[model samples]
Target chain A: MNSRSWFRLKQNAPKLSMLAYMVLFFIFLLGPILIVVAISFTETEYVAFPPKGFSLRWYERFFEYDAFVDSFIVSVELAIATAVLGVGLGVPAALAVTRGHVPFANTIMTFLLSPLSMPLIVMGFALLFYLSALGFGVSFLSLLIAHTVISLPYVVRTVAGVYRGISPDFEESAAVLGANRLQIFWNITLPMIKPGIFAGMLFAMLISIDNLPISFFFGSADTNTLPVVMLSYLEHQFDPSIAAASCIQLIVAVIGLFIVERIYGLDAMTPAS
Target chain B: MILKRSGITTVSAGVVSPWWIAFTGLFLVVFFVLPIVNNLLNTTELATLAKQRPISFYYHKLFTDPYYIRIVFDTVALSVGVTVICIIIGYPVAMFLVRHSGKWSGFIIFLLIAPLLTSIIMRTFGWRVLFARRGLVNDFLIWADILEKPFMFLNSASSAVVGLVHVLVPFMVLSIASVLRSIDLQLEESARILGASRVKTFLKVTFPLSLDGIGTGFIIVFLLANGSFVTLLLLGGGDLKTLPLLIYQQFTISRDFQFAAAMSNVLLAIAVGCLYLQLRLIRRKGVKGS
Candidate 1:
């Protein structure tokens, strides 16, 4: 080959390597999950990959247990309650931080978001100790409060981000139209930041459902969240049933993301850098 | 509340109040701050066990105990290792996402986001399955004649690191990508037009420009890794014991409330230190960018 063509080929080499590396990274990210979903369909008694002779038996077995069903319902309940609490507290706080001339607004914002930096295990211990001290004990109520503490930051961050993007023009114009403060907020501000509010609530729900350490610490006999139950069960057993349950969770999360993407876009929902 | 007869701008200024801040602030204080503060205060009980003892009792135990010291060392070492590995792997994927655009980029991003949204417990379980004896990884290695016998893969420090990197790589990627996307491509173009090669331009321009993101991502992954428990518990296989695991044991298995409270305070201090540094870095970056 000519020297010119050789140089051109060399130029393409780095691009080719980058493409190859990207493919490998994708595989690394998705391979385990695809394996788990595949293993859940195994006809074998144990968890196997390239899963032996596909069967729906494990999924059937997962549904047969009332414990799994109850644990799942409890998790759902906790997530919903956490989302409600998060939004109720988060939206107004977002407004206060973004619009209100509160002293030390930056510090207050940091305090609201501080839990994101905390180790869940540490938070779990603190919550457990504090609740016991207050006579709350380990119960669903304590679990809900702990989950809310963990999830509230998502709502605050997402809504504040969206609110910051919105100019005060609409609210000002509404005020000029002789609308009162509450009316201006409900009529002008709320609708403008609805997408952010929705994104925050969805994220809060997802975080609450996926949480493990707090639930493990605060849950009682009848209050085991799904992750807590699956974890404790996995300690003793290795079977396709756990895989089946994981698939259910996988589907739920995927559905949540897809809905958020459709409505507000995934990039908007991701953690701000 | 009616504003005095003033213009619209004045009315708008009067609308905001500190009372709104109190609503969420109170909720956070009661639920979030109070719990942790209560835990910290409980450490004082360590001094009065049976009678008026010294406050240094639990603190002395934590510092003097070889097991606790080892746990702290392991936690820091594991977190550092995972942070290094994540940045190595995550930087390229992030670059690919930022430089490339199309259906493939969307699909790749979905692949990235899906795992992040899924439960950490579920993802760790997948690793547990993969690293099990006679699992896929073992089976593949054996089939390829790489191993003479099935080696135990789960519960090692390596397994815990692998699990943590998997769990946290997305955070690294997202943080870096967010900053990478904000970087001006024109700077790279200008560098190239000024007679620099692609590699040199990226090395001198793009990489330098993305350092803030790198710092942010590193801090995030480091914090999460330090605080992580589920991955270590599930994958650290019995061999790995982290500070979080020790705290859990202290609180639950041993039921040493005061000592556990003391340990929790130390862990909190470490985590909060990192967090404080991170917030400062981000604030400085914001100032420089604007």
Candidate 2:
């Protein structure tokens, strides 16, 4: 080839390499999850690749075991309670930081977001210590408190994000027109930021359900969360049942994310800052 | 009557008040701050258990113990390794997503976000299966004539790192992609018009502009990898131990809360230190960018 064509070929070579690399990288990331999903449908007793004749027996077995069923119920209930408590605490806090004249607002926000950076295991271990010191033992209440604490930041961040998006002009206009504070918040602000609050609530609930490290520390003989139960079960037996259980979580998360996307777009949830 | 008062109108009119702040503050202080503080104090409490044993005893035990020290090193080294690998692989993905912002980008972003939202235990379980002796990876290699038999891939540090990088690369991609999306396309076009090659323009303009995202993604992945134990716990076999795993064992199996509390405090300090550096990088990035 001529010099000019050779230069063009050189450019295309690196582009081709990059394309190939990205494809391989994504495959590395996604191939495992797909394999597990594929395996969950296997008809065989063992996890067989190319999954010998798909069947839903493993999923049936997942429900057949009472422990898995009980733990699944606990996870759902805990996540719901966490979402409720998270919103109850987080909304006011988000409002306080964004609108209220709270002293050191930035510091307070950092403190609230601190858990997002802290290691869950350390948080779990520390909670174990703190609860015992306060004469509270590991129970469902402690589990709820832990889940709520971790979920609070997501709620606050997302709510504060949407709250910031709303022009203060509308609320100010409402005030000028003689609407009371509660009336303005109830009628104008809440309606406008409803998508954000819903997004945050959905995220908080999903994360609570997916949580394992903190739940592992707080789980008792009778109060194991689903993820924790799956973990302990895997420690002894690696079966298609575990794959089915894991798929249930995967399905729930995907649906929750799709709903969040539908409501407010996942792009809105991305922390650009 | 309270709403009618104009003197307190500004405070009341806004959605938040001191009471709201105080309420959330109290909950955070009790549940969040106190637990961390309790761990700190428990370290001291363990130190004072006997007159002969002092605070230094725990410190000496922790720092001097070769096994525990190795765990700390292994955790940090693993995190660093994972972070480096993520940035290398994630930068291209992020660049692709940002530059090709259309139908394909949406699907790609969904692919990235799905694994992120999945349960950590499940994700780790997926890796565990892949690394198993009879897993797909080994089977594929054997079929390709790359190996005579399935090698011992499971429970190794490399396997654990593969699991971590799989989970965290998405975060790295998302962070960098968001930053890249904010960069003006005109900058690249301008550079090309000025006779710069594609590689030259990317190196001189694009890469530097995206450094903030790189820094942010690095710290986020590193801190998370350091804190994470599930990947290691489920994927790591034999004597492989990370700081989190050690803390877990101490707290649960040994029932050594004080020692576990000490280890946790140490880990917390490391996390905070990384956060401090990350904040500095962010501030620097902001100053330089603007």
Segments in model 2 whose C-alpha atoms lie over 4 Å from true places: A1-16, A268-273, B1-15, B43-55, B285-290
lDDT of 1 by residue, B41-136 (tens): 764234354334444687887778898788777878888889999999999989989887455777777778889887776788788878888887
lDDT of 1 by residue, A1-273 (tens): 999999998999888899999888877787878888888889999777778898999889888987788899999998899898889989989888888877888888888988888988888888876776677888888988899888888899889989899888777777777888889778888898998899898999999898887888876668999998898888788788999999998788888899888877777555544
Off by over 4 Å in 1: A1-10, B1-5, B14-16, B43-55, B143-145
Q: State the TM-score of candidate 1 restricted to chain B.
A: 0.90
C-alpha lDDT of residue B86 in model 1: 95
lDDT of 2 by residue, A1-273 (tens): 899999998979977877787789778878888888998999999877768998999999999999899999999899889988998999888888888778888778888887888888888878865776677778899998999999998999988889988888888777767777789889998898888789888988888998888999888877799998998898888888988998998887788899998887776544334
User: TM-score, chain B only, every model?
Assistant: 0.90, 0.88
Question: Which residue pairs come into collision in candidate 1?
Answer: B155-B236, B155-B237
What DockQ do you compute for every candidate structure?
0.61, 0.55
Candidate 1, which CAPRI tier? medium
